[model samples]
Target chain A: MELLMAVSIGVLTACGIYLMLRARTFPVVMGLMMLGYAVNLFLFSMGRLATEAPAVIGRAETHADPLPQALVLTAIVIGFAMTAYVVILIIRGRKTLEHDYVDDRVNERDHGVAEQGLSKRAVAMPETPASAEADGEPRP
Target chain B: MSSHLLILPVLLPLLAGAVLLLFSGARLAWKRPINLAACVALLVVAVLLLLRATEGGAQVYVLGDWVAPFGIVLVLDRLSALMLVITAVLAIPVTLAMSAGTDRTGQNFHGLLQFQLMGLNGAFLTGDLFNLFVFFEILLIASYALLVFGGGRARVAASMHYVILNLFGSALFIIAVGLLYGVTGTLNMADMAVRIAALPAEDVALVRAAGLLLLVVFALKAALLPLGMWLPAAYASAAAPIAALFAIMSKVGLYAIFRVHGLLFGDMAGPLAGLGQSLVWWLALATMLLGILGVLGARDLRTLLAWQVIVSVGTLLAGWSLGTPEAWTAALFYMVHSTWMTAALFLIAGVVVARRGEARDSFMVDARIASPVVGLAFLAGAVALAGIPPLSGFVGKALLLQAAGFSGDMTIFWVLMLCSGLAGLLAFSRAGTSLFWRGPVAEVAAEQPPMPLMPALLLLVLSVLLVAGGGPILDYLAATADAMLQPADMIRAVLGDRYLPGGA
Candidate 1:
C-alpha cells in the first residue's frame, strides 16, 4: 500500500512538472492543480496507510493517525479556492490581453491598455506627446 | 491585563475585518474612521505586547485549555511582539494612505487589509506548523486581492505570477509539515523539537529531508536567489501602500527560518545541525549580488525599490545564516530598519510618479518633479537605502559587518556587503541625477493633487527616529536576541519542564 501510494505521488508530480513548464497559462494552472493533488495525497499518506482501523481511540489497538487527515482536508479547501482564483484571473487576462501566454515579453504589446487605465485613474493629468512618442504611437 | 491579551492582536483584526465586510456599502467617511481607529488600537496593543514580552520569559496561550502538544497554542515572546509592533507601525501609514483615494479604486480594501493583519499577527504568534500554514494562506489570499485592488493590467499580470508561485510554496510547506509530523507524531513546534532531539539515529535521513524541504519553501517565500524571480515585477506593479505593507511579508519567511531553525535544529551537535545553513549562506550571497544588479538595471523607481527590498533581505539573511547571537541581534536591527526604509521608499516613489505625470518615475524620461519637498523625501530615502552614514541603514549595515566579523568566512561577507553597498550607491546616484537633476522643465506644469504626504512623511520620520534612537533600539534588539538564542526557555514554557532533555 505504501509503495502504491508513493508511485502514485511520483507520477502526479512528474506530470505536474511537465505541464507547469508549458508556456501557456491554462496548462500552468492545470499543472498547479495536479501538484496540489499530489501534495494533498502525499500529506494524507504521511500517516501511513491504514485499513479497517478506527479513526478515534477505541477497542482496537491500532488507529489511523487523524492529524494528517485533518491537515490534508484544509489544504484541499485552500487549494480549491486558489485554483478558482487563478482560473478567474486567467480568464480576465485572456479577455484583456487577448492571449494566454505566461511570458511577459509576449504580453508587453498589450501593456498600453494597462497604461491607459493607469493614466486615467492614477495620474489625473492630461497626456503629453512626448509620453505618447515614448510609447511609439501617435497621440490619440 | 490577563494573559489573554495576547490573542487580541489576531482577534481584533479578524473582528474588524468581518464588520467592515458587512458594511462594505457604507460611505468612505464612515468606514475610514473605523479602520483608522482599529489601526490605532492595533498599534497600542502591539506596543503593550512589546512591553509585556520584554519583561522576560515566553508567554504561552493554549486554546480550549488543552495541553501544549494536543491543542492550538500561541507563543508570544520578544521576537513575535517586535514583529507585531513593526506590522502595526507599518499598518498605520498604509491604512491612512489607502484612505487617500487608493481604497476607492477597489472593493473591500479595508476588510482585506484587516484580514491581512490578522493573518500576519497569527503567523507571528502561532506555535503549530499547521496553524502557520493556515495563516500564510489567509495572508497570501488577502495579499492577492490587495495586489490587484487598484485594477491595472500590470497588477493583474503580476498578481497571477505571485499567486501561482506562492501557491506552490504553500504546497511544499504542507508537504514538509506532513513529513515532519509523520516522523514526530506531533504538530506543535515545541513538541516536535523535543521529539526530533530525542530521535533515533536511523531516522536522521527522513528528518533531514523534511528540514531541507522546509528551508526550500522558506527560501521561495523569502525570495532567496534562485527562487526569487516572482518578487521584483510583482512588487513593482503593486499599489504603493500595499507594496509598503509587503515589505514585512518576505521577512515572514526569514522569521520562520529563525524560529524553526533556532528552536528545533540550532544545536551544533544535533542530527540536522548545519544541514542547510551552508547552502543558505551561499544562496544569500548570490541573492545580494543579483539584487544589486537588479537595482542597477531597473528601468523605473518602483522596480528599483523592489530590487532594494531583495537586497535588504539578502543582507539580513546573510548575517542571520551565521547563527550567532550577535549576528541575530544585528539582523533583527537590520530587519526593523529595512522594513521602515523600504516602505518609505515605495511611498516616495508613488509620490514621485504622481507628481511627474509624463515621466511617471521612469529613469529614462526627463520630466522634472514639481515639488522640492518630494524631491528631498526621495533623496533622503535614496540615501538611507544606499546605506550612507548617519541613517538607519548605515547603522544596520555596520552592525551586520561587526557581527559577521566573528565568522570564518568574514572576508567574503565583508567584500560582498561593501561591494553591494557601493553598487547601490552608484545606481541610486545615477538614477537620482537622471531623475531630479537632468530632467527638463515640464511644459504643462500640472498642479500636484493633494497626494497624502503625511504617511510618507511619517515613514521617513520613523527612519530618522531609527537613527536618532539607535542606541536604545540596539540595546532592545540585543535583549531580543538574547531571549531568542535561548529557545529552550520558550520550549519549556510551551511543553512544560518534563520535556527538557535532562529535566529540571
Candidate 2:
C-alpha cells in the first residue's frame, strides 16, 4: 500500500514539475493543479496508510488517524480557492499581456482573443493601441 | 488586559474586511473613512497588545476551548505583538495615502487591505503550523489582488509572476507541514518543538528535510536571493500605497523564520540543531551583494527601494544567524527600523513618481520638484536610510555590528554591512542629484497630487523617535530575545499540561 501511494505521488509530482517548467502560463497553471493533487494524496497517506477503518473513535478496535484527513480537507479547500484565483489571474493576464508565455517572447501566434487556455492579443498597446474610433476623435 | 484580547488582532480586521466587502458598492468618501476608522482601531489594539507583551511571557489563547495540541491557538509574544504594531503602522499610512486617490482606480481596495491585515495578523498570532500556512495563503492571495489594484499592463504582468511564485511557495509550505505532522504527530508548533527536541535519531533526517523545506517557503517570502527576482518588478509596478504596505511583507517571512525555525531547529533539537545556520549565513552575504548591485543598477526609484528591502532582509538574517540573545535583540530592532524606513521611502517614491510627470520617478528625470517640505523629508529619509549619523538607521547598524562582534567571524559581516551602507550612500546621492538638481525647476505642475507625502514624512520622523527611545526599546527587545532563546518556556505556556514537563 505504501509503495503504491509513493509511486503514484512520484509520478504526479514528476509530471507536475515538468509541466510547470513550460513557457506558457496555461501549462504552469496545470502543473500547479497537478502538484496540488499530488500534495493532497501525500497528505492523505501521511496517516500511515490504513484500510477501511473509520476515523471515528470507539466504533472499532482500530481507527484511522483523523488528523491528516482534516488536514487534507483544509488543504483541498485552499487549493480549490487558489486554483480558482490563478485561473482568473491567467485569464486577466491573457487580456492585458497579450501573450501566454511566462516571460517575454511574444510572436505571431499570440495575437488575437485568448482561446485554448492562452491569452488573446493584448487589449491595448501603450505605443499603438487599437480602438474603434479614429485618431483625434473626441469624446461625445 | 484580558487574555482574550489576543483574538482581537485577527478578528478585528476580519470583521472589518467583511464589512468593507458588504459595503463594496458605496462611494469612495464613505469607503475611505470606514477603512481609515478600522485601521485606527487596529492600530490601537496593536499598541495595547504590544504593551501587554512587554509585560513578559507568551500569551496563548485556545480557540473553542480546545486544549493545546488539539485545536487552533493564537499565541502572542513580544515579537508577534511588535509585528502586529508594525503592520498596523504601515496599514494606516498606506490606507491614508491610497485614500487620496489610488483606491478609486481599483475595485475592492478597502476590502482587500483589511483582509490583508487579517492575514498578516493571523500569521503573527497562529501557534499551529497548519494555521500558519492558512494565514500565509490569506496574505498572499490578498497581496496578489492588491499588487494589481491599479491595473496597468505592467502591473498585471508583474503580478502574474508574483502570484505564480507565491502559489509554488504555498505548495511547498504544505508539503513541509505534512512531513512535519507525519513525524511529530501534532501541528501545534510548541508541541512540535517538544517532539523534535527529543526526536529519535532515525527520524532526524526526515525532520531535517521538513525544517529546510519550511525555510525555503519562508525564504521565498523573505525574498532571499534566488527567490527574489519576482519581487523587484512586482513591487515596482504596484500602486504606491500597496507597494508601501508591501514593505512589511518580506518581514513576515523573517518573522516566521524566527518564530517557527527557531522553535524547530534551535539549540533544543538534538541532532538537527543549527541545521540551517551556515546556509542562511552565506545566502545572507550573497543576498546583500545582490541588493547592492540591484540598487546601483536600478534606473527607477521604486525598484531601488525594493532592492533595499533585500539588503535589509540580509542584514536581519545575518543577525538571526548568530542565534545569540544579543543578536536576536538587534535583529528585532533592525527589523522595526528598516520596515518603517522602507515604507517611508516607498511613500516618498509615490509622490516623486507623481511629480516627475512623464519621467515618472526615473533617476534621469529632467524636472525638479520644488516642494521644500518634500525635499527636507527626502533628505531625512535618505540620510537615515543610508545609515548616516544620529538617526535610527545608524543606531540599528551599530547595534547589529556590536552584536556580531561577540559572535566571531564578525569580519565578513562587518565588511558586507559597511559596503551595503556605502552602496546606499552612492546610489541615493545619484538619485538625489537627479531628482533635486538635474530637473528644470518649477516649470511644470500637475493636477492635485495622487497621494499625500505627510504620512511618509511622519514615518521618517519616526526614525528620530527610535533613537531617542532606543534604550528602553532595546531593553524590551533584549528581554524578548532572551525569551525566544528559551523555547521550552513558550512550549510549556502553550501546551499547559499536554506537554511532557521535562525534556531538553
Q: List the per-model TM-score of the A chain.
A: 0.74, 0.73
Error of 2 at B376 (Å): 1.3
Clashing pairs in 2: A98-A122, A112-A120, A112-A121, A113-A120, A114-A119, A114-A120, B366-B439, B367-B439
Clashing pairs in 1: none
lDDT of 2 by residue, A54-123 (tens): 8998888889999999999999999999999989988988888777777642423343222322322223
Quality class of the docking in candidate 2, CAPRI style = medium
Task: Supply candidate 1's per-residue lDDT for B333.
Answer: 90
Q: For candidate 1, lDDT tens digit of each residue in A1-140?
A: 88888999999988998998887899999999999999999999888898987679885888988888898889999999999988998888777656787765554544555566545544543456555445544233
Per-model clash counts, in order, read 0, 8
Name model 1 segments beyond 4 Å from true. Answer: A59-61, A107-140, B406-408, B441-450
Per-residue alpha-carbon lDDT of candidate 2 for residues B320-417, written as tens digits (9 for 90 to 100): 88888988998999999999999999999988877777777888758878887878888888888889988899999999999888455778889889
- TM-score for the first chain in candidate 1 comes to 0.74
Residue A113 shift from truth in candidate 1, angstroms: 16
Best by TM-score: 2
